[model samples]
Target chain A: MKKLILATALVAISFGATAQRYFSKTAHIKFFSHTSAEDIKADNYKSTIIIDQATGAVQVETLIKSFEFEKALMQEHFNENYLESDKYPKANFKGKGDFSKVNFAADGTYSVNVAGQMTMHGATKDVSAIATIKIAGGKIDGSTKFYVNPRDYNVQIPDVVKGQISEKIEVTVKATLQPLK
Target chain B: MNKKVIIIVLLSIIAIGGGVAYYMWNKPKTNAADVKPNYILPADSLGAAFAKNEDSANAKFVKDFVALEIQGVVDNVFVNEGNESVIQLMTNTPDYAVKCYFLAGESVSANKGEKVVIKGFCTGYLMMDGVQMSKCALIK
Candidate 1:
């Protein structure tokens, strides 16, 4: 009888480890560009992200053509000329971090150091950022802000229109995670 | 020379004016739709049942109904349900749905395991065949 009880406890703990994985997505993604004439900014708050609590494993993806612009014509150019969304329809990220030892017991803010490979326009790069993580009421929230250069992902800016667009753009990401099981 | 130039300019104006009037009178009419401000994803819905297929052709991409194949459930939306009982779908997605009115004696819906592609403007009401407006239906 004691052996049966012990075995059940072991299974429960192991199951808990995997069951803690959570993810929430709203397709919320934003992009910004700067130019001498005006700043171009667009965002869609519907990006998707998933995280494994025990392993700190993170996977993120956003629709490339989902970026919204204020001007209809500008949006058309972005998809056809700049982002080339048809060829590369998604920007993806897959990375792992250490969350087991982190302080998640309280309802406060934590600045987490992250290192991962972000794939945009079919190219992957190492990325590191300080993401703010919040835990409350059995829910976990994460957000981060960063910048991307067009050249980093081979995004082309024609010289004739170079003055109309910015060289570097800011990107911000936010996600909420819910228990999967 | 000055008189000739002025005559040319006046004639040009007359021709252009006539052309403008003809174009305006013969141009195809566009159905202007109202902006629909509300679209909410259903709670805990997943893709399961298939949208009923009817033998329909000439189905306005999203005329009879508005639906989003979100997660799994067909979140069929109608700004205001009135006379249109069924809609033929041209596209469906997790985020949005586009459809049109069907007049052909045939029906079309997404096939099994097929996903919706494309996104478009959403409206608050449905407009019918340039004659009158129904409550509200999804349009392509």
Candidate 2:
């Protein structure tokens, strides 16, 4: 009986160590397009992200309709003609990296490679980028900037306004996550 | 036809085309306060609708560009990193709440535990963030 009790306690300890997760609901995700004719930008501040400290796993999800553009006409065209947000309202990213070298107890910024599957506009593609993880005051701040071609994700750009939009769109993700209690 | 008549017709076409192009370029964003809500109910019902079937809920409230007026007790209120006010309303699901993202520079007067009505457009629901509403306005 004594041995069995010790084994159960040890299992509980191991489970607790592997279940460390940090979450944030209001991550900021912004995308910009620049061209000779025009520069357009949109911001989405309601993205949800979860990071597992034990396994270095990260997941992010944001609604396509949540993105707000400066011009209503451009936003309408983006939804109706380009993205078709009514059909695919969510964009998701799931990736993992090596977090073994970093010590979460201390404050520092570490650069890591993140490889993931990005799903948007009903298309999924593999993506890899260098992401920065900043630890301060026991909080995790993760940020990454990357570029993606809209056509790769099946985003059709009409030829009439091709000059007004960039072929490659710049995407930035930033979030400050707190330990999940 | 006379050359003079043809010249006048061509000029008129160019003028009308310019006007239409300008209107499309200068269209305004949607303001929740200025538009009538397509659905009016408690926040809990909205949350439950999404919880039950996300696709149908999105098709009905989000894809159709439906505005909603939700009444519920305030779960919390805070300003996001973008300097926009965000209000969370209590729902039947303990793990989820209705998040309303108010327009920039909009003042939110409701306090925690207060029952209030909020008007906004349903952007859709994230599994982790529940139902999200943008361009929010305080109705009461």
Candidate 3:
């Protein structure tokens, strides 16, 4: 009976160790487009992020409509013409990295090469970026910057303002994830 | 005389176009105070609806662009990095809640477990997360 009890306790401990998942409801994700004619940027603060320490897996979801642009006209054009947020309301990324070297118990920063598929505007594309993961006070702060060409995802820019909006948009995502309850 | 009228008409059209463009460029973001909630219900029901069928809920709320006023027990309240008030309302579904994002200047005055009503535009439901509401305002 004691042997069985010990075996059960071991299994329970292993399960606990593997469930190192952190989540954040309000992550910040910003995208910027720059051109000689104009510079446009939008910010989305309602992004949801989940990071798993065990598998080095990360998932992010942001509502396209949640992205707030400074100019209402720009926001409308982005939603109606560029992104079509009504049809594709959410943008998501699911990816993993080699985080086996990072010591979660210690406070430090680790850089990992992440490869993920980003789905937005009813299109999916592979994306790779080097993400910085910082561990501090039992929380994980993750941030990554990457560039994407809207043309790759079939985001058509009208001829009238093609020069005003840059083809490549710089996207930055940051989240301070807390331990999942 | 006809040529001069044509010039005046063309100039008037150009001036009107420029004025419209200027007004649109300077238009401000939507204020939460001006929105009327299209759907008023318990927060738990809204979460459960999304958990049950995300597509339909998303169509009705996010795609259709309907605002919502949800009332429930406050799970927690905090300010995000953007200095916007975020209030989480408890739901029946496990690991899911109604997250309401208030405008930048709106102050949230709700404690954990306090019952409250919040109105906002439903953005969408993230898988494994709860429904997101933006530009939220405290109705009571």
Candidate 4:
């Protein structure tokens, strides 16, 4: 009976060790476009991110309509015309990186390269980015920046306002992840 | 004289259209303070619904910018990167809570653990853990 109890304890401990996934629901994602005529910026704070400490895999999901612009008309135009967010509601990224260089148990900052597929507006593209990850006081903070073209995601701009929007949009992501229980 | 009149009418139409477009591009936003909430419930109730099924909660609360009045204890109060005040309300479940982003220049007088009612536009669930509400106004 004692041997059986010990075996059960060992199994429970192993299960606990595998539960090293970190999650953040309040992550922020901002996209900016600059042109000679105007500069447009939208912020979305409802981004969801998960990072597996054991495997160095990361996943991020963002709701397109959650992005808020300063102007209501710009928001409406982005949803109705540019992104068609009602049709394609979400954008997601899944990537893998080498986390062997950093120790998850220690508090420090590590820069890593993540390569993944980004899916948005019913189109998927391969992307690689550098993410700065910091572990401090039992929390994981990460930030990254990347650039994307709307045309690559099947987002078309009418000729009338083409000059007002830039071809490449700069996207910035920030997250403070907490360990999942 | 007919040609001149036609040109004048065309120019007037173009000018009017330009003015309307400009007005639309710079129209004033709806005041959240004046709008009535579409739904009212406790923060725990909303969090529970989202925890149970994210897709359903999103369909009901997020598809249309539904306004909500949620009551709960203050879990955290902080400012975001945009320098906007945000209040985090605690729920029954751990890691699942209501995050309220207040409008610019708005302030909350409530401290942590104080029960407060907030009204805002529900942006739906953030993953399986959080309910996001923006442009929030405290209703005591």
lDDT of 2 by residue, B33-57 (tens): 8778899999999999989888998
The CAPRI category of model 1 is: incorrect
Candidate 4 clashing pairs, residues 3+ apart or interchain:
none
Best of the two (2, 3) by DockQ: 2
User: What is residue A82's positional error in candidate 3, in angstroms?
Assistant: 1.5
Chain A vs native chain A, TM-score per candidate = 0.86, 0.89, 0.90, 0.89
Q: Write candidate 1's Cα lDDT for A1-181 as tens digits.
A: 9999999999998767654766664435677877778898876543567767677887777655445566546665776787775456557778876665455546877777777999987788887777788888766788888788888888888988888777777888877756655
True contacts kept of 4: 0.38
Candidate 4: which docking quality band?
acceptable
Cα-based lDDT for every prediction: 0.52, 0.87, 0.85, 0.83
Q: How would you class the docking of model 2?
A: medium
**Comparing candidate 1 with candidate 3, which one achieves the higher TM-score?**
3
TM-score of each: 0.59, 0.90, 0.88, 0.77
State in Å the error of residue B109, model 3.
Answer: 3.6
**Per-residue lDDT for A40-151 in model 2, tens only?**
9998888999877778888899998778888888888888789898888889999986766666668999998888999999999998888888999888888999999999
Per-residue CA lDDT of model 4 for B38-82, tens digit only, reads 888999998988888877776777654568888899998987666
* 2 or 4, greater by DockQ: 2
Winner of 1 and 3 under lDDT: 3
Residue A148's lDDT within candidate 4 is 97
| Backbone clashes in model 3, listed as residue pairs | none
lDDT of 4 by residue, A1-181 (tens): 9999999999999866865887887789999999989999999876889888678798999878678789989988998898876567678999987765666667999998988999998999998899998988777798999999999999999999999989989999999987777
